[model samples]
Target: MQTGENEQALRKIIDFTRLLSIAILIIHFYLRCYHTFYKLKLTHEVVDHILLPLSKTTAFNTMLFAKLSALLLLVVSLMGSKGKRDEKIRAKTIVTYCVTGLLIYFFSSYLISWPWLYMGATSFGYLLFMTGGGLLFRMLKLRLGGDIFNKENETFPQEERLLENEYSINLPAKYQLKGKERDSWINIINPFRGTLIGGSPGAGKSYFIIRHIITQHIRKGFAMLIYDFKYDDLSRIAYNALRQYGGRSFYVINFEKIMHRSNPLEPETMLDITDAMEAARTVMLGLNREWIKKQGDFFVESPINFVTALIWFLKKYKAGKYCTLPHVIELSLVDYKELFAVLSSEPEIEVLINPFISAWRNEAYEQLEGQIASAKISLARLSSPQLYYVLSGNDFSLDINNPDEPKVVCLANNPQKSQVYGAVLSLYVNRINKLVNRKNQQKCSLIFDEFPTIYFNGIDNLIATARSNKVAVTLAVQDYSQLKKDYGREQAEVIMNIVGNIVCGQVTGDTAKQLSERFGKINQQKESVSINSSDTSVSRSTQLDYAIPGSKIAALSSGEFVGMVADDPGNKISLKTFHCEIQNDHDAIQQETAGYSEIPFPSAVTSSQVILNYQRIKEDVKILVDDIVDSL
Candidate 1:
């Protein structure tokens, strides 16, 4: 792993050769200058014949050129060999070599006759080519992606090996190099698998994500779905900037003022009666959280079906009026005498009605009543005052995928009042997954802070297909085991696998071990030696070791995150909060939020409106069922 000693050996050999070559050229010149007086014949025709390239006529020029070539070769070889780290190429090396070459060319020409030296330029050129060509060829090969296989400096084929040298991991290291170029912005490509941000509390994870990552993406015109679970910090931080700097619309589904409304079954989401029925089933299943272990019993499924059928009947007959969550609770409150009479002709809802009717007719209706009670209790939370307020009215809706005009939709769920807001948060996550489709391919980001708190059933499939839709997802959590606990082992693994870009901050326990293994192992050369009174032995061997251990991950400081960006697979990036002044102008931010200030709080719906909605649905269902029965 260490290279100082080996590089020193190579440097010594090259230095010795350079000095000897220069001495030979210098001593030959000294003898030639004194040969006139001493009448020396040390450089006779026989000696020139032995030295093939040292022709008698252009002797000084050829020798000087050879000496200069030795120095240039040394410069190139010492540029960045394994050991001598300090020998890396620098501005000084090129400057020194250029000046030395020019001086040698002139002095050699003066020593040999100028006319003859000019003739020996051919020999000088050959020497230069022979010395520098291999080095130049090597450099060209490295710059051109190396040889066909690139064995000399092999870059591992993606995930099989940890490419620690890649910019994704060794990032900012590349940026800090002596001379590097950059464009206006750093473009990261193909980063759609979503980023998983995990860090300890007070680790500055939120600040980095919002200030550095989220602000950058929004400025680049990416539509965002920011789920501010901690507070409205993300919403408050991004609201004005989104509209002013990003040139986009801003929508907030705020729970504090009931500032926004969302109908999950809204036609735009494409969740028809059957879809809502399935959603109801999923919700009831999640209430027990039994499905996280194994499939639910008949008792749980029976209640889910009964609720689904009622929701189905309401949504089927009432297009807009009675299909809201409030209506579902209102209809459930009606007496069985009136409810059965109203749904008498419908066969789909008959499944629940006949069972209740038969149990009553037989005077053994305890089981049927208990099922209704279970279903009602689970669905009751959906009709809570705050949830109904936020989910019922259609004062506004989030149009996230609009490509011509980008948008940022912030769903504010204050963690302090999580019990009141958790249901609505889960609803929004589910609804957005239903809304995203392949129709629009604009760049979008779904940022979920405190991700484990909200469980959306379609998240696995959503991440799988987001790349084609050009959507990115960022889920922030405190730990990895939390996901496995929320979603069972099999399902949790699926979710983690789909999110290829993992941005892990200081984490402990299983999360750290998992990431440490993911970084993979590297091949390193190690040396061992043994000495005794009788003999001595030395040997070098290769060993495999973890590139980055779990302890290192656990020791990461605040503002530092080890991430594997999707754009750069097989490599992990360790990023720190650089001193970057993002232009999150508060004035622009206020201007953006002001655009929606005129929207009033959702007005209370009167009893008359509720009755009218129910009457209209009953009338429509009656006519449709009559026609169906007539056809049958």
Candidate 2:
């Protein structure tokens, strides 16, 4: 932002500096002529009487050198103060200023020598002056129209200032830049902005995410946490990329088969009670949003509070391995007398335990039991054996606190395990989001594929605030209906409103209409036909219509996407719609897919990943050994 301000200041200074420079030249010319005429030492009579302002033609140009030198220093100092990438912009400004000065100087000098050529110089000067005037008028018009010329609204040509494929620290490249003028380097789209991508199946949305947003950053070494939904294809590709890049580790949370365990209670949150409470709400809501919606907060708030208090206690006091959700389920079903006894000795937990103990003793104890039962039923899967094994250990963790090394995590959507682990996924997202915002020492990118498949409410708020904390969220979804269904209509709207970059592929129904509305309106040429039926002639008139119909957006081809990305600082085209093409990489994809099917386990854990407990593995082996002995 300081860089942009400096550039604007330098530009204005150059404008006034040129006027001063011209004034200096005129003054110096007069001074030299007056000195020579006063000295009266010219050799030729023709030189003495040359034109109207005949005077000394001094070979020594000391005054001109001094004035021009001082002017150059001031302009150079201004250019030197701007930020790094502004070097190119500053160079261009300097070159243009020098060229304009040279043009005026040469034309004026020649016009004095051959006065007839004054006509041509006058014509060129008039043209240049008029062009500058028109530009000034446009700037004035824009200002009066309420577009404040600040860091956000400053205009720059984006087409010429391309940042290339190697640069990646934040979410810098959302769309290709259009810019205000030719020869102006292409500027990056919003670097610190969040994006939401929408596309139906096989519309090439995933391909777009890979090529445009993640791939470069992955290669450039920005830490990332990706939720690869379909088959862990994205995760596998990123794993290979991280390996090739070297020095960075890859982690996986495979739900289909336990490749590795990341204790679900890992660092519950550093913040006091609020963070833990929000996580509890997320889990309960994620499990049964419709139920909670129907019952309202009054019915659900107490259960959430109960869970929240437990979460806070566990996270604050216990190790991550022992702080699993199963502990909560076990405590919930235990006798109230036992629970009271357990809380009796712990002074810190008495405040938390008092409310639940009193609730159970109420005259409406059965009603309270029903509410507690409802929350427990929704969370009953947490007590299952397979999931318990997966949530118990600390084998792999995906942390994006460090940007020098990138990280990626994949959560499998196993049907058998979905009910058990769905809430865990929500918890991880909520926790990771907290980590990203809290441990904001380095920038991180989190990509959630088919994001609506694992909906959360705070996603909109995350998108809005993540930029400040240097975290980027990349969400991909099929359609608006899915969002509305999973997150409700109001939250879906909030998500749409907060996301800075909206990328849409071929979509139909409400999603198409939403994208069309978001891509906004455009002025398009049209034709109108008129007829005069006086038995003589017919007149036809053509005109332009100011609109882009929604049908046009819906008809976009596969691999083609329409987007409205936030503008870069100093970018001229503010919130303009752009079309991007992301062609499928068939061979590369085939390699990634083939590798996944061949792996004995999804990750590097072991061959028998389907089985969970180590004791179960031994039990099965012992049973087989006994059968073999009996056969012998």
Whole-model lDDT for model 1 versus the true structure?
0.58
Candidate 1 lDDT tens digits, 1-632 = 34989778876776675565555554444434434423554456654455435434343445555445544654544443322112124444444544544454545555454433542543354344433432332221112222332122211122222233211121221111112322111223345666677888865567655444566667667777888886567776676456457677777787566566667656445355567655665566555455546546667667776767666666656454456656566566556655556555456677656776676567666886776777677666655555555566675455576776566777777767664465556666676666654656467788888887666677788888877787777778888788888778887788777786666678888888888777666564455555555533446676776545577667767755555555454434333111111123458646754663243344555556544644554454455445545655
TM-score of each: 0.60, 0.63
- Candidate 1 residue spans exceeding 4 A from truth: 1-188, 285-291, 340-364, 404-406, 525-540, 568-632
Q: After superposition, how far is residue 612 of candidate 2 from its true place, in Å?
A: 9.0
lDDT of each: 0.58, 0.57
Estimate the Cα RMSD of every predicted model relative to the unseen true structure: 13.6, 19.2
Candidate that scores best on TM-score:
2
